[model samples]
Target: MEWNAPGEWTPAAAAEPGQPRKGILLIHGLGDSPWTFVDIAAELSKRGYLVRTILLPGHGTRPEDVMYVTADDWRQVVRQQADAMRRDVDTLYLGGFSTGANLALEYAYDHADVAGLVLFSPGFKSLSLDWLAPALAVT
Candidate 1:
């Protein structure tokens, strides 16, 4: 029922019950699922982190789901989960790949409570259609 599912955010197994919680929320890119971070989450878990990944709405499902999805959909998911995690963990981090990184960046900007951010292949520049390029372009 946990991570064996394609898109579930399974907590790391090594975390203790009462320690100062350090949690990481991992997000996958377009057309991908939480499964993308399985190995990384497991490794982080082994290192004593509470690792959770989320299935952005319209993801881990049929391709048609993406066609109807919007930026608000992605933002809403990250916002809600990050907000919830902040209450549950002493330290909360957001890590993502590609478009997921874009969502994480925006969420981190708006939510300063986040402890740190881990991004891979962040794609906001290309996906933003040059709108965010002037200010956010990594290059």
Candidate 2:
């Protein structure tokens, strides 16, 4: 999948004029990029929805960058995208996977105007990195 660099943002595929939008903002998991949601976005677009995926801070370019970013950085990016979408569409939806889901939840909390949320493998709290030390060491 093609990846977007940090600080780079892309607009959602446009819908036909007068077509009511099902606006969706898709967030990628840790170490992943907006490209992760290409399939999902395509499917949503086919279903008459305007789907946009965002690359969170320090993601999509290098894994090392992700290690340097704080959770708040991620939250800010999601919030900015959500706010932009809210201004353009009639109904808004947020969705993501893993840590991305957490960011989505945080966005929803701040933006209660969203119509709905769709989470995949949502995380209520952080996962224990210590538990995966063995696997991480090998990688």
Q: Which stretches of candidate 2 lie over 4 Å from their true place?
A: 5-17, 126-139
- The number of the candidate with the highest TM-score is 1
Worst 10 residues of 2 by lDDT: 5-14
**Candidate 1: regions farther than 4 A off:** 1-18, 127-139
- Top-lDDT candidate index: 1
lDDT of every model, 2 decimals: 0.78, 0.76
Report RMSD (Å) for each prediction in the order shown: 6.3, 4.5
lDDT of 2 by residue, 1-139 (tens): 3667322222344435665666888998987777777777777876667778888888766667776778888888888888888787788999898888888888888777887888888878655776785677533
Instruction: Report the Cα lDDT for residue 32, model 1.
Output: 80
Model 2 whole-model lDDT (C-alpha atoms): 0.76
Clashing residue pair totals per candidate (backbone < 3 A): 0, 0
RMSD of 1: 6.3
